[model samples]
Target: MASNTFERFDLESSQEWKPYIARFRQYMISQKCDQTLYTAHLITAVSNRVYKLMCTLCHPNKPENTEFEALVEIVANHFGPKGSVVAARYEFRKREQRLDENITGFIHQLQLLAQRCEFDDKLEENLRDQLAAGVASDAIRQSLFMEKNLNFTRAKEIALNMEAAANTCKIGKENTIDNKAKINTSSTKSARRSSSRCWRCGRIHDEEPDDCPYLQFKCNICTEKGHLAKMCPQSASKLTPYNTRKREGYVKKRYHTRFSNYFGSDSDSGSEQSEVQVIVRKKNKKRQLRYVKK
Candidate 1:
């Protein structure tokens, strides 16, 4: 097996010493370094401050030499998870997944925080609860809560599946609504096109009615076919007074007959007679007609 080079350790930045030492230990294990040379190798890899401290404690002139196990314990006591437990717990409790954040990223964050907590057997259960609490979606939370045997691995799987399903459903609904809007817009355009009337001939057509053959034959004033009355020079003169009076009498007689039928009255003598005067007012002129009903 190839040996891995150990990175030098720093003592001034005590916060990073724990992981640094852990990695150094792993490298030592892989290299199968002997216990007798463990302290010597560790002393060689550390910064000046740590190197001087180790030299003072394990010098040959000293009364006592520090053991490798005791050195490890001293480093751990000074820089290990003990000092970070409260901060880790605070962060874990405050951790919450954002709606836009992926569930994988949120779960990974929870895992890192759980490591610092050092919950022992309760680690898995605490991780599960944190995972459930941090999820942005209520549906996923409900699904996780419904599980009787929830664990970190199972919770991750279920939460991922639920988040995916929710996204799919949201996309489907948006697509459906978009399709409906498009259909409605297309139908409105079709209806408007179908109901369109040509300005020239005043008739509905697929194309403009200006080119129609009947357009030239139709009259504007009388609305008749075959000729335009306005263009015709031989127009009829106005009616005479005698003909006008005769036309008025005919209209008056027609109105009386229609009203009598509507009232269902036949015996002229027994029924009471009432006069309904209709006044036709136009501009500044007024014309009145008296209808006698029995």
Candidate 2:
């Protein structure tokens, strides 16, 4: 591994001490750094403020005489695990990702917490369950649950692939919706342009001919083409016919009055005189018709 990987191991807070020391020890072993130089490497890897503070409190004697195990114990006592293993396990169980947290970062955090819990044969199973539980996507969780013989490595790979596919699908759907919106906007503009053209004269205007007085040529009264309501022939015909129906009603009323005069003009006799009035009115109507013709 690169030397820069150890940079993040610099302990800044008490919570980081456990994982930091564990990773540092692994790095030292892999690099085959001499056990005599462990203290020097530890001091170099930590932050300047922590190293200075440790030097003042821990190195009261000569720095070369300080035992490695004593220094490790002192650091562990101040910043290592404070509670029992059971409490650590409980915290690991409750570990979850926030809504805005990244999935891979959350899994890595769970793995770090699991190390402190000291899970053995059940470590991969526990990590898998926690990984699935803390994932923000339900699709990945369900996919993990459906697997028969899933281990941590395979589960992680599947989850990553599923997350990537979901992001791609979301982007595609958004692009499709944007394209549809553009198409609908263009279609609406075309419809508005078409509606502004007059159907009768084939001329374009700001409004349709039915609503625009300058563009409209049909008569409103007669509903005919090529004329306005002011010059409509049906307008004069409508005025002339208005009193015709009223005059007809007046003539019928006069005829009924003549029948009533000849019939005895009594309310009780109306039913008995109706038949005679009908016969006499019909004969008088025919004679009046002949006199009018002459």
Model 2 lDDT per residue over 78-101, tens place: 765366889889999899877777
The number of the candidate with the highest lDDT is: 1
CA lDDT, candidate 1, residue 80: 52
Which residue pairs of candidate 1 clash? none
Question: What overall lDDT goes with each candidate model?
Answer: 0.69, 0.67
Worst 10 residues of 1 by lDDT: 236-245
* lDDT digits (tens) for residues 1-294 of candidate 1: 323356777766644766676777788888888777777777767778776665565455321256777876665665552757888799888999976689999988888888888788998888899988888888889999999878888999999998788889999999999999999998887678558865545556554455544566867656666444544333323211221122432322122222334345453645554445444444444567666565
> Evaluated with TM-score, which candidate comes out highest?
1
Q: Evaluate model 1: give its lDDT.
A: 0.69
Quote each prediction's TM-score.
0.61, 0.47
Stretches > 4 Å off in candidate 2: 1-71, 78-81, 120-122, 198-294
Each prediction's RMSD to truth: 12.1, 13.8
